[model samples]
Target: MNWDDLRVFLAVARAEGLSGAAKTLRLDPATAGRRIARLERSLGAVLFAKSPQGYALTEAGQRLLPRAEAAEAALAEGRAETAGAGGERLSGTLRIGAPDGCANYLLPQVCAQIGAAHPDLDIQILALPRVVNLSRREADLAITVSPPATQRLRAEKLSDYHLSLAASRDWLAAHGAPDGPEALKGARMIGYIPDMIFDAELDYLAGFGVTRVPLASNAVSVQLNLARAGAGLAIVHDFALPAAPDLVRVLPDRVRLTRAFWLVSHAGPRDARLDRFATLLRDGMRAEIARLEASVA
Candidate 1:
């Protein structure tokens, strides 16, 4: 019946492991386990079934999930209301999940500015190569290359960014620039591993008839580094070009592609502070992309 116990239960359910839940809550694993045991004793029902894989919720645990989530949301709403009433700066944690490319190139500056304004805000950027799982509460918000297909999440287009074939100046100078996309067949290519691409938007080389990549990685930052090292031609984001001055577009006119970033979050009532933060994030990303792209142009 204790709200704190319910909070611990929700964390364990989402993380699917006591250690992970304990890490999130900043508690010792033994302490978290004891809390769960206490909660089960109070409810007179076993909540989790432990296994080698992890914790699996029991029927009783499943039943309590939604109600626990509602209580958590209500607590968040109350905090937001109190903060607004007092005109206090944004506090507590905000975790954002994003592909490594965006996380590395875009978010640091944007988040730094937000953090500067609200010194109390604790922002964590999870630069994961795969799509962030909002359903499991991996992150409070996510920036994705494509809009999520699920109805449980809401998506908003933040910006359209360009990408094109690029290679280091030295590489082009040594091997000669490709006359067009067709000439790329002879060049060493760097791109995402064919089977490892997590999203359709990340399959940047497929449309160009590129079925082979001699050098490949799932992470964009790694591909960029390969291109920068003069390993091969790779499709590079225009906004990211500023970071690698040695690299230049190879076939800008004939090989240009456009993609967008979507701000994705769980669909439901949210804290007003989150709403304001989202606005700042959206506007900041748009401006940063434009400014970076223009600099390279």
Candidate 2:
């Protein structure tokens, strides 16, 4: 089997669609589709079931997955070994999945430093509202508020981040800042949509007495932006405070919450590049956390 064709197959299997796989592999949809078709023909098997929802792997494809992944891992090990032999810095894409808040507030700077140190490395930061599945190879590493429960994954505490009630100066002046959570009743509150919150850790408003969120979005940045726009008060992460200096902390001492960031990766033989990259992430996160906490202080 052609390794290049198998690579395309692996991308399609993971993405579950030609277009998504194409985009990820930086190939046009036509090229990706053609490659898959060629691979299927060479193997004499239908690899995927086509449907409106997306591509679903056939039994043949499922059977081929583990072997493909093993080959990929071996290739990665070879690359790492080659780089080490040359006494060169690690090179390749390091994909990180993180919440929108962390991605927006913390990762850009961290990624910049990582990029500067390893000019050949490409860092792909997926800063989205939904969790990235490391098991599916969606990300090489993930920064999550909660650790994964799966035994196949290894997690380490990255840092503790603080969240507190905040509102814009204009909103506080017009509506008066709440003395505590109780006063938030009937207050214009910006938060995650009640039912759409992807992670339990994101259900921040549940701790408060208020059940309804008048203004809501799944994205943390959207909630913070709305708060800055004087729409309402929000439980904002301290790291984001630098972006909206006009946002006044409301009852910082009384209404405060802390969440731990965990660095998660799949369990397996350690890759030199991943280990070095993880170190960079840990140091960067620690520095950023200190900077953010100091800003609030």
Candidate 3:
């Protein structure tokens, strides 16, 4: 229950014997034994079964060992990030993943800025729609809309952005723009193929009466390209829409859609580098959204 008890338990579990644990803990062998006994007594469990070679942890001690070590590790991280530890330079690899739109927009900017600020830190970026697996260490940080439920991971809502359907003026002139969701029933839609990254966007659009006419390009870039060329309407995030001048918004009133992107990381001491990068991203995105609204206005 006490920190000392846990520390003593960890010392013995790691050291393999009371004598070795005593040396590690800077205490006498009998004192180490006494502490272990008291720890076991407090919990009403046997900590170790003695042998000629060393002490072997009982099932209970084996179970307790990992938890105690994790607690210690977490505690150390907490101390490192505390008030007195100001300007603790982060020098470690931080793996991160986010959706492709982010990669296209601000992923590089954020990474470059953070990398410049913290010269010793290395960053790896993976951009995809599917949530990265924190349990498998696929990423140390993630930006996604996925709900966070992993045991040792943390997640928070990062920011929100809007989705828009765009089509070239000529495309609209030929096919005529849909006045309502029902009108979309006959219009050609540039849908992502079944297994592509933006398939979920197509699924969302299907509810709006926009049936899939499947464009030849399976990639989002190609879909946007075709949309710009007056091929068909493509659903795209507001962040990536402005680059194409020819593409105009299609039935904004009928398109009832908004999505929140979340930022996730392994739960522990607050990562200052990640924290700084998140603030930069959040502010930049807010500015971008405001600019988008102003342009529409």
Q: What is candidate 2's lDDT per residue for 128-240, written digit by digit as tens?
A: 78888998899999999887888898776666678989999998889897767788777788999888888888888877777989999989899999999999999999889
Angstrom error at residue 68, model 2: 45
Best-fitting candidate, scored by lDDT: 1
TM-scores of all candidate predictions against the true structure: 0.70, 0.70, 0.60
lDDT to native, each model: 0.84, 0.83, 0.68
Query: What is the descending TM-score order?
Result: 1, 2, 3
Q: What is candidate 2's CA lDDT for residue 279?
A: 67
lDDT of 3: 0.68
Model 1 residue 133 CA deviation (Å) reads 0.1
After superposition, which runs of candidate 2 have C-alpha atoms over 4 Å from their true positions?
Answer: 1-87
Clashing pairs in 1: none
Model 2 poorest 10 in a row by lDDT: 76-85
Per-residue CA lDDT of model 3 for 29-117, tens digit only, reads 89888988998999999989999999989999888865775566455435333423356555677777876666666567556655655
Among all windows of ten consecutive residues in candidate 3, which has the lowest summed lDDT? Answer: 76-85
